[model samples]
Target: MTTDIAVPKSAQSLEPFVAAGVFEPIDIHAAGSLARLITGLEPEIILGAALAMRAVREGHVCVLVDDAYADIDLSDNAKKLPWPTPEKWRSVLTASPAVRVVEPSETVVVAPGEALVPLVFDGVRIYLDRYYDYELKLADFLLDRSGSERINVDESEIEKTLDEIYGKLTGEIDYQREAVRRALTGRLTVIAGGPGTGKTFTINRLLKASRILDGGRPRAIALAAPTGKAAARMTEALSDGEIKATTLHRLLNITPQHPARFNADNPLPFDLVVVDEASMVQLALMTQLFTALSPNASVVLVGDPSQLASVEAGAVLGDIVTATTPDPDSGSVNVALADCTVTLKRNHRFSAESGIAELSQLVDAGETEAVLSCLRAGHDDVVWIDPSNPDDTARVEQETIAAATQVVNAARNGNAEEALEKSIEHNVVCATRYGKFGVHYWTDKIQNELLNTILDCGADRPWYAGRPIMITHNDYLNNLFNGDTGLVVSQSNSAQGLDELKVIFAQDGELRRFNSSQLGEHTTWWASTIHKTQGSEFDRVVVCLPEPPARVLARELLYTGITRARAHVSVVASEAALRMAIETPALRASGLVGHLRQSE
Candidate 1:
């Protein structure tokens, strides 16, 4: 006779078991034998395991295991078997550290949360604490691997390389020369600076110096960035076909179906790797990149730390820089950090007298009065558009449209081709929200109302000449990635009577046709949110600061948008909105620095 056992197969089925004092979701994979495992275990151990599982799953580095049990129940009829009281659970977790029945190797080690409990199982793989463990492991891995092969190059040698690449150092201190010298001395180097700080110049010199130090034996170098536009920019700066830049995803062989083709077991094949726009890289992604790197390979990270961080769950570059001791009271230098990090301060994009440069500094420092003064000043580099009615969103929209119209008339001069070229040169960045005062509103106003080009196809969202479109997804075959923007050169009806668009992306340099159907799911109008403009720049920038400042109007966002402008910046904002934006700084939660400090 066979006895039928009711197994919980679905999430709903597991719900009843959970309420009845069963394993948490963290152990859901082992749900089949959970009851059998619990049969002989003490009530306190069972309860403690559940709490420990939850904490680890929640990405906590460590938590007191004996803390209050909020989710589980200990009432008289809560379970059929005897359940441990909250006090008893705490007592079990709070006990002195003791060994479990399992061997040290077999035990899945966990910290304070469960105190002495090993939380072990015979065949179960011990899971690392999601982000915290990754952070700790990465920190130790980098420290162990870095400076293992410090290529010693004289200061004069570095100066010679810089002079060859770039004419001469402008400032009293040759920051570019110093950065190259630092890069050669460490396997892991971070080149951090704000906009127009000659980061590209420093990187080129570093590449040249690395070759010199290595006996000019053509070192294998790979350049990568978090996004396609950033990669394209890096490639453009290097102007080397043999050493072309690629997106991190493509470089790692990441696809929709898999995390990566390259990992710890199969590391990337390269002698030196340079990651541009490092600030946009997430911590998890950074960890993956590091894991895939060969032990002795040199790595360089370049970006502006003050720019908007990754949209995901990490402020990686900021965390890494902050981990280093800025000023030691004991006057002892943090050689590990100092040797591996270079902060570039000289601005090459703008002159010392430029208003855009002055405004960025003020915004970065969160100085409301200084920023306001800079914006209000009659400077040729800045065009301030203060709406008459601060409370009226409609008025702000109209005022912005008027400013955009003026820009169009000035740049276009009634030439169709010139209009298309000018549109790409200038970008209208909106505040981080989707409403009447955002990208959608401005895209419609600019495309439909302001510059009404005749539509070639009859569709819901018809394509017209000079319509700016941004790729929202990566298309490896087309060599396009998210944040890549283009203008519609032409449009027509396909054989299937579907609307087709031919877009020419600036990144491509040459005109490569893309069908509208191919872009339907991946394209968005060019009036972008501040986040999308992180790794891009334009000749002119028109920033639409929402009339009633939203919470998302972070100082970094405003500063990033402003800095995107190379020549001019037109701001459409009320005084109140501008002040709020300047005052509010973006805050991201991360613990990489804490881990780094603990390791130190």
Candidate 2:
């Protein structure tokens, strides 16, 4: 299987240099299915090419075959082949028509598929085939709107109508009016900002202005979010429940028949679609959403770019914002894209002079020292607890329990369910990771110590009365969705020796019973990670940070967790953790912007 190639003796230096740096090798056995897709490649290069392609699909730039034997699994017939050194990888990969080395180094190989444009990189790396297809498809879907006819509306008339609609709102109407104007003039609109920046308010006005422009006839508008909780919030924000919102999945009709019932062949039946909390929308989901839209339909994506990206993969909103953002010096950008983007700046949730607003600005700007200074200065809305110290460690747990004191006391006294529900709605505890200092530790402590309730059904999963659980996946039959919260009300053992539990969802008061064995342990969680708390708001938030800043403590995580609090934020972490959270930005490898620019 070894390729016949000649190498100069002078070039036989193994200094251990990689082309695009080192990347963690993927589990090749788990990716065996992809191996079948690769055809007409040398036996020696087949494993390497498949592993590299799988790595790219998993969000890595390249795959490294560092160790010849350990990095890959060899069959009985293949083990006889020579070890795949860097020189060997280069020569074999170069000879194969299925894969090629982008760099001179022999360590990296990428599959060049039909969807990708000519592979080129100065500082930017090629997205390979799988990621390249996603990026290229999404870019084409978004850019197709440029050729679609825009709404016919007079600028002065629309501006006057926008002013009238926004005048009823609290904040200044200048930004809102401008955003509405751009939205009406463009087929694709993106509204980016942080919390309290009036994105929802602006969207409401945009709908009103669009109706006004259409001679007072309401356009067919559909509202959606990435999660049910976010959709519920969006529904509550606009028109006081007049405009309903649904999850993007439900809107797309994603089912066993296909990933989406609606697609390019069968477009969505709406003239305008507004997606709120767009930050939580992953690249694949966004692509599905866009592909189903009618070419002439107007789309508005509203999200906070400073918040954490979607938990799965891809940064749709962040990439769009970065690509469309204009240069400060020359104000140069794609005119069509610039016209489609709007940044809301005014804060309505927090007062202009509030410390929470100041802290948020600092976090957004990556001013680590300034944030620490504010925390040290004792900001009224920002509470900092150093868990590294013994006293503060206890304080961190105490404060977390104190945040839910009302709910815990109500449960203990057997008080009215209404009051307990009200108390639970106002408080939340968030952790960066699910390890020692994360949600599992805090949830177990709260259930064991505070509630003093436990149920063992011969399974590792624990259940108890008054246990707070968040749904981790959408259950279509039960009408439960990811991000939905619930409380266990009752539990019992059936004659079949099965454990059953009754729970009440926050979305609805109906108590439902289900067997413990019916669902996986991961379907529910007692406490939530910070990423789970995205697009959610609570009056008070207790952020539990591990003593040592882990890789999960990124600037966006801290910002998203803190912004979830409306009244106050209590951060439980060491000083070093805060510094790490403030300094480190979340890194996501995506080529969305590259393809987006190519389309323009």
Candidate 3:
């Protein structure tokens, strides 16, 4: 028999427990009707009816209760009550010989003339045997009542499934994966790394992850870098259709020499702000950024302390972390400041064994000398190519033409195969003339000779005219002598769409003559002074250090020029220049002489 039960309005208060699926409502009044219907049956049958009625009420097949109900007094049992007191219900069930008392929530029925128990409840049936006395297996009893089947899977398949599930669960959704999770849960994180460690990569990841977790797209995200150049690079890397990134200066409209204008009244309009290249960020800038943040906004700063420009000043990232100490006067202010610090410690750009990489590590460890030692290892390849003074301009012209002819012959006869194998596809020959005093001139005598040689060798059939011969005077000049051959002189005449071999020539008078105009416009030019060559690198270099300067800066300039060559270098200098390089303290301290000795 089934009874319709009305759920109480108070059931809404039990939503938490109901959602947990641990309990169900029952009508105790209806259970008494089932008890009366089975009154005339055998005691075992009557007990089974009571168990079935309790199961239907509780939404489970097994009912567990205290054993105080075993001695129910049935003095008013003849009355058809809708609910029975424990005293009235227990007396009838315990008197039956077929009913066996077990543990709480357990009952056993014995069949006619058999030691085993046959249990019947509504449409369900259970058989019990007393092999181990009357002890009941709770799990087995639940399984019999639930009547669900089990399936087995292979070990490998199960392991693979678990791995995939874990990967999906732990995978990064957006840049906010860790930071936002921690923030929501109220935790602080620090992200730190050395040069090329993908600090910016982490910042972008955090931004993307946060957007995914927030359900809808974020209204705005702020991107910041310590310097204008770094911010520009990050903007380029992160630029897409939706996301916008800018340098801290541009975002805040602050100039390098001006006081910051950011404040609480005109706060940055973003839910999240990511700062890149944070190592270069000064405390002043950070203060401005913090003040301009929105009330509920989050900020992420990324940088490497070892690469900080102010390393000697001890304006390190660690100092910033330490300064976040709590102050009694400003409680929330200290908490907000502490919440923004995150450190990331992974190096992604260089291999762990690389010299530059090791140098970065040494700098981080505060070992400046070790960093200098790594720098003194010098370029990976340095070759010295020397051509003796073959006379002045007249002889140089002759020898230069001769060298061009030799190069053409080598190319035609496959003698330049080694350079070709090394991916050197073209060669440039630059020729210039020097007059007495300070007059300078360009003589394309060598270029014309090489052009003639290529024609004679049938190299012209493949079109060799587009090859660039970079002649540096003041500006770069470009010309297409034919549809095939192209010439680039100085920067003034440079064209955009072409790759050409660069030839550099330093006229003797030009070297002696210091005109700001003599510097090449388009192509690489031979510089007479070493100072101008600082921070420049070249595949091959020819240095003509004539009259050495008496000043210390001149020797330092010379050191700079010597270090520019990557694969090949030729030094044609007066003996005085060599003496200056050997004697100058700056040169010695730079360790050039020691480097040469080690190479020998």
> Best candidate, lDDT-wise?
1
How many backbone clashes are present in model 1?
Answer: 2
Which residue pairs clash in candidate 1? Answer: 65-113, 501-516
Q: Quote model 1's TM-score.
A: 0.73
Q: After best superposition, candidate 1 residue 297: deviation in angstroms?
A: 1.0
TM-score of each: 0.73, 0.78, 0.35
TM-score of 3: 0.35
All candidates' lDDT scores? 0.66, 0.64, 0.37
Model 3 segments more than 4 A misplaced: 1-180, 183-190, 239-241, 255-262, 309-318, 322-341, 368-600
Span of 10 residues, lowest total lDDT, candidate 2: 11-20
Tens digits of per-residue lDDT for model 2, 1-600: 122222222211211111112222232332233334444445445445334454444434334444333323345544554446666665665665544234321122234553332222212233344444455577776666644546554777766776677654455447767777777766788888888988988888877776777786667889999998788778767873445888999999996557799999999998888999998888878989998998778888999988988876578888888777654664544556656788989898888667778888898899988898887877788888776567876775666666455554443343336533644454545655466658777776655555432333323445544456667767777766778766555433567675344555544233345444444333334357888888778777777766543556778888888888888877777788888888888756665655555444
Q: In angstroms, how far off is 32's CA in candidate 2?
A: 4.8
Quote model 2's TM-score.
Answer: 0.78
What CA root-mean-square deviation does each model show from the true structure?
A: 8.9, 8.1, 37.0
lDDT of 3 by residue, 459-576 (tens): 3332232222232221212211110111211122248654333222222111111122433443311122232222223444444443435333233333344444444444444444
